[model samples]
Target: MDGPSGSGKSSASRGVARALGLRYLDTGAMYRAITWWMIEQGVDLGDAATIAARSHEPVLTSGTDPDGPTIHVDGVDVGEPIRGSEVTAAVSVVAAVPEVRARLVAMQREIIGSGDIVVEGRDIGTVVAPAATVKVYLTASAEARAQRRTAELTGTTVEAQQAAMATRDTLDSTRKTDPLSMAVGAVELDTTALNLEEVIAAVLGLIKERT
Candidate 1:
């Protein structure tokens, strides 16, 4: 699955994978994991040179269980830390580095090589796994997306989240490598007004048809 943050890629993909008995991988979390490690190491977020030089230093591991996906960096489970406001703020900057994306994209491809899995990321369908059998590009209204993101981003109002996500969308979509976009044959699913079950059913229906 491919989509901007807050577009229901992570949640809806997990639900679809669980329903289909397939593993799930959230590539966004992997980027966040690296960003968290960089912060912990005192790396300057604005220094692209330093960040790129050390992009491969920390080891990132992704757990593929659809029901409870996990991500760890250097042996520490960073599922919670990666979601913090600090990490969220810097992740886009770090993710914009070409070196960071290259490292994480390799890891994502390796994870998907072993078995059937549902992976969600900005460029999964376009760059990370171009040959994926069932490519889905999800979208939603900016207002709806921000409203959904507000639940987890404490201290941030829906308006703030919307603004932040809008900035992130621009940064991500214009990055030099593997920018966010729909693949040639991807199925575009608009979730502007769909509930969780409804979205999952729609993606599941796509997978069922392919199988």
Candidate 2:
């Protein structure tokens, strides 16, 4: 699974994982885990070399539950901290580091080696799981994505939310290391016209047909 944030990639991927009895991996949360670690260590976000140096400093682990999985960094649960506004503001810079992607990609590869996995993130299908049995690229219109993010950000104006999403989209798409892109042969589902259940059913049907 792969798409811009707030595109229902997480929700739909989780549902698909459950319906298919596969492990779920939120690769974005893994990057968030590293971002949280960088903040905790007071590493300057602007300095990619410094962040890259400690890319291996902490052990990051994530619960595989399709719903409400937990993420930890070096034995400490940093889930809440990783999702904070501060980390959200700087995660793209950290995630753009080549070394960071290399480290995380290795870990992701290891995690998926032994079983079926539904991995959600910007680069999973394009970078981490190029050979996945079923690669899905979930998407939605900017208006829809902004509305969803506004709900999460709690009472934010739609304009502000839209602007932020635009910036994030630019960063994600233009980043040097494993930037977001649809993989070859991947199925693209525009969720702009589909409800959550409908989206889930469509993805599940795709998997069933393949199987």
Candidate 3:
């Protein structure tokens, strides 16, 4: 699965994974884990070279269970810390670094190679797993996306969340290294009016049709 933030990628991905008895990998959390590590080490986010140079220092481990997915950084579980506002604000910049993407993409591919898994991220279909059996590009209306994000995050209004998502969309889509895009054979699902179950069912239907 590949989509912008607040497009129900996480929820739908987890649902599909659980329903299909497949492992789930949230690639965004891996990026967030690295971003959290960089912030904890007091690395300057503005310096791309510095971020890239130190990107390999942290070891990231992802627990692929859809029901209880976890992420760890350097032996410490960071599932919550990586979701904080600080990490959220800087993850896009950190993820944009070429070295960072290269490192995490390698890790992602390794995990996918282990067995059947559902991976969700901005570039999974186009970069990480181009030949994935079923590629899906999910989307929603800007307003709906903002509302959903506001509900997930605390201390953020819908307006602010929407604005931040817009910035992230621009950054993720325009970044030079593995920019966000739909693969050639991807099915584009606009979830603007679909709830989580409906979205998951639609994706499952697509998988069935494709495979």
lDDT against the true structure, each candidate: 0.92, 0.88, 0.95
Worst 10 residues of 1 by lDDT: 106-115
Model 1 C-alpha lDDT per residue in residues 1-211, reported as the tens digit of each score: 9998888998899998888788999999999999999999999998999999999899988999988899988899999989998998888899999999888988888999965999999998899989888999999999999999998667889999999899999988898888899998999999999999999999999988977
- In model 3, the Cα lDDT at residue 192 comes to 94
**Candidate 3 local lDDT, 1-211, one digit each (tens):** 9999999999999999999999999999999999999999999999999999999999899999999999998899999989999999999999999999999999999999955899999999899999899999999999999999999878889999999999999999999999998888999999999999999999999989998
- lDDT score for candidate 2 against the true structure: 0.88
Candidate 1 displacement at residue 70 in angstroms:
1.0
TM-score of 1: 0.97
Our tally of clashes for model 2 stands at: 0
lDDT of 2 by residue, 40-127 (tens): 8999888889999998998999888887778989899887888788888888889999999999999989988865878899998889
| lDDT value for model 3 | 0.95
lDDT score, residue 202, model 2? 94
Q: Tell me how many residue pairs clash in candidate 3.
A: 0
User: How much does candidate 3 score in TM-score?
Assistant: 0.98
Measured against the true structure, the TM-scores of the candidates, in listed sequence, are 0.97, 0.96, 0.98
Ordered list by TM-score, greatest first: 3, 1, 2
- Identify the superior model by TM-score, candidate 1 or candidate 2: 1
